[model samples]
Target: MKTRIQELRKQHKLSQEELALAVGVTRQTITSLEVEKYTASLVLAYKIAKYFDLTIEDVFDFSELEEI
Candidate 1:
């Protein structure tokens, strides 16, 4: 999945470690999310989205999945 996490983090001046701490995940998990190496659980997605004051749709791209 494609996500705006990196962009949002940069815009918010949050490092991966900081974001991970805020969202209760590991820095490596943030890195994985940014790189698309792993998909987030619904809870994690919700936490991440909430952290940015955005809905999950705003943070994550579901267009490709919508085609299915």
Candidate 2:
């Protein structure tokens, strides 16, 4: 899956650690999410999206795999 995490973080001028703190995760988790190395649990994804005032679909896109 691909995400606009990096772009959003930059737009908000927040460091990975700051975002992680806001979303109740570790900095490494944020790094992993930004690089697409980790798939968040439903709760975690919701927390992140809520922190940004966005919906899960607005932050992460899985439509590319819809055909599969």
Candidate 3:
């Protein structure tokens, strides 16, 4: 999934480690998410969106992917 994570993180002046710590993930996980190398779990996505005061759809773009 395409996400606005990197952009939002930068805008908020947050490092990947900080974001990961806030959301209870490893730095590598945040790195993976930022680079689109890994997809986040539903719970992780929700946590991230909530931390940013955004809905999941605002953080993750699912327009191109088929729905389950």
Candidate 4:
């Protein structure tokens, strides 16, 4: 899935480490997520959304992928 994580982080003036710390993940995790090499769990997603003061739908979208 593609995400606007980098853009959002820049908007907030946050480094990858800062975002990871805020969302309770490692810097590598944030890097992986930004590069689409990892997918976040629902709990992680919620934490990220909460940190950004956004709803999950606002931060993430899965419509481009088809169901299994």
Candidate 4 overall Cα lDDT vs. reference?
Answer: 0.88
Model 4: residue 26 alpha-carbon error in angstroms = 0.3
lDDT of 3 by residue, 1-68 (tens): 89999999999999999999999999999999989999999999999999999999999999878676
Q: Give the winner by TM-score.
A: 1
State in Å the error of residue 13, model 3.
Answer: 0.3
Number of clashing pairs per prediction, in order: 0, 0, 0, 0
lDDT of each candidate versus the true structure: 0.98, 0.92, 0.96, 0.88
Off by over 4 Å in 4: 66-68
Error of 3 at 16 (Å): 0.4
lDDT of 1: 0.98
In terms of TM-score, how similar is model 1 to the real structure? 0.98
Worst 10 residues of 1 by lDDT: 59-68
* Best candidate (score: lDDT): 1
For model 4, the run of ten residues with the poorest summed lDDT: 59-68
Give stretches of model 2 more than 4 Å off.
Answer: none
Please give, for residues 1-68, the per-residue lDDT of candidate 1 as tens digits.
Answer: 99999999999999999999999999999999999999999999999999999999999999999999
**Backbone collision tally, model 3:** 0
Greater TM-score among 2 and 3 belongs to 3
Angstrom error of the Cα, residue 3, model 4: value is 1.3
The 10-residue segment with the lowest total lDDT in model 2: 59-68
Q: By the lDDT metric, which is better: model 1 or model 2?
A: 1
